[model samples]
Target: MSTVTVVNRLEIRFADLKKAGRGALVTYTMAGDPDHETALAIMKGLPAAGADVIELGMPFSDPMADGPAIQLAAQRSLAAGGSLSRTLDTLRAFRETDHSTPVVLMGYYNPIYARGVDRFAAEAAAAGADGLIIVDLPPEEAPELTEHLNAHGIHLIFLTAPTTDARRLPAVLAQAGGFLYYVSITGITGTASADEAAVKDAVAALRKSTDLPIAVGFGIKTPAQAAAFARIGDAAVVGSAVVQTLADSLDEVRAATEKTVPAVLGFVATLAEGVRAARR
Candidate 1:
């Protein structure tokens, strides 16, 4: 086990939520979507709009787990010159003003691998990333990046799908830090609606093995859905729905950029309200 020296932002944020007796509202957006400046504006505004945590998607050409919304967002990001280097630069810039809100980089592993695991970990920590969620990196192959990330005080967040059985749960929980992201639905992102009863049962089962906070994502589109998940888990993660909002608001690259920030923030505030009101 790697010892974490620095105070992790995720731990702090979740602790604050526990103290407040409210679930967290975690939002996700692709880095440099539409355009770099617009995406940065959205990122900076998220915390103020009631986002407890932010997951910035590092654009990759082949995102297997992502659905059309996130895939399109990645395309737009790459088209606008979003790269691993650019993503870190955006994080560094965001850190200048908002140093408290936990930010996690979520995407596939190829980009990180191409950058070299050790170097990517070092750069990510230097750029103020609090954690990472590599969709394709299984626990068996995660040590390469986890060791480096853990050493730098950056958490390597893991995902547990509906298909993850009891026998496989331990392995996933072993490498998980910051939080465990539960894929609410069995398939790809943003396609199906999560079954509330199933999610409740899954969270209950997961709690028996690990004390880490569990955040449910995928198929969570509405505030009602987010509230339901929040009541069941420690936090609710909203991604594809928010990304779809960006897609709908875009006119062109620059015009869409102008509309994306406010539109996404407004939607996030509603989701936050739902999460905060859960169990109250």
Candidate 2:
């Protein structure tokens, strides 16, 4: 684990991950995925490959925003005996050697309710998690959850989709603590295209709501696609593509991640470097 550095805001952590001279390859995976014990192996493999941050997915029986690929991954992870307690333990184990990489838990709210918010927040914070991304409970419905996480000094990151209009941006930003996560594409996750012009527009709109660093995700796979996102948002997140990689073949997953983690993040890292270089 890297030394714990005092950070004023979660965006700083995101910025640090981007320091690899690439955009952030924010990979998502169910905690007890493929096999639960193998999760740490997967996590350990990611940082070296190119993953700046990890979206440590807490697998729920039902994932609303998720399409088939992620839903299946959740089932496998659950069947493998993955649970929030074990997931927290996995992260606790991770902190024994890896302290610097930012980890955010993304999932729905039902499991959280089942687990009890206070207990969840306490364990998550104690285990060294950086933040949370609850998909179903939008800002208006998030007071109880966000309040608890905030009280424990954990960030509750929110999703801002392309369809999020001006009226919605403020509400999203108000509930958002970490970096503002912008969903570059709409509908389910894992759809991709180079039409980032709309992404840039969303970024601009989000900028009006908050000065927080913006990390865009949804259907972002490959280095070229990552670069496009980094040009517009502060960071970019890659989910289902990598999840699919892991689901298809763990070896292929690692190989593919080795290619993408560095590939995508390297693109963002260069952008981060450029931003730093420009000041010189």
Q: Candidate 1: TM-score?
A: 0.97
| Candidate 1 global Cα RMSD | 1.9
- Top-lDDT candidate index: 1
Q: Cα lDDT of all candidates, in order?
A: 0.91, 0.72
| lDDT by residue for model 2 (209-278), tens | 7877788888676656666776577776777766776655544333233343333334434433443332
For model 1, the stretches where C-alpha displacement exceeds 4 angstroms are 1-4, 252-257
Best by TM-score: 1
- Cα lDDT tens digits, model 1, 212-237, are 99999997999999988988999999
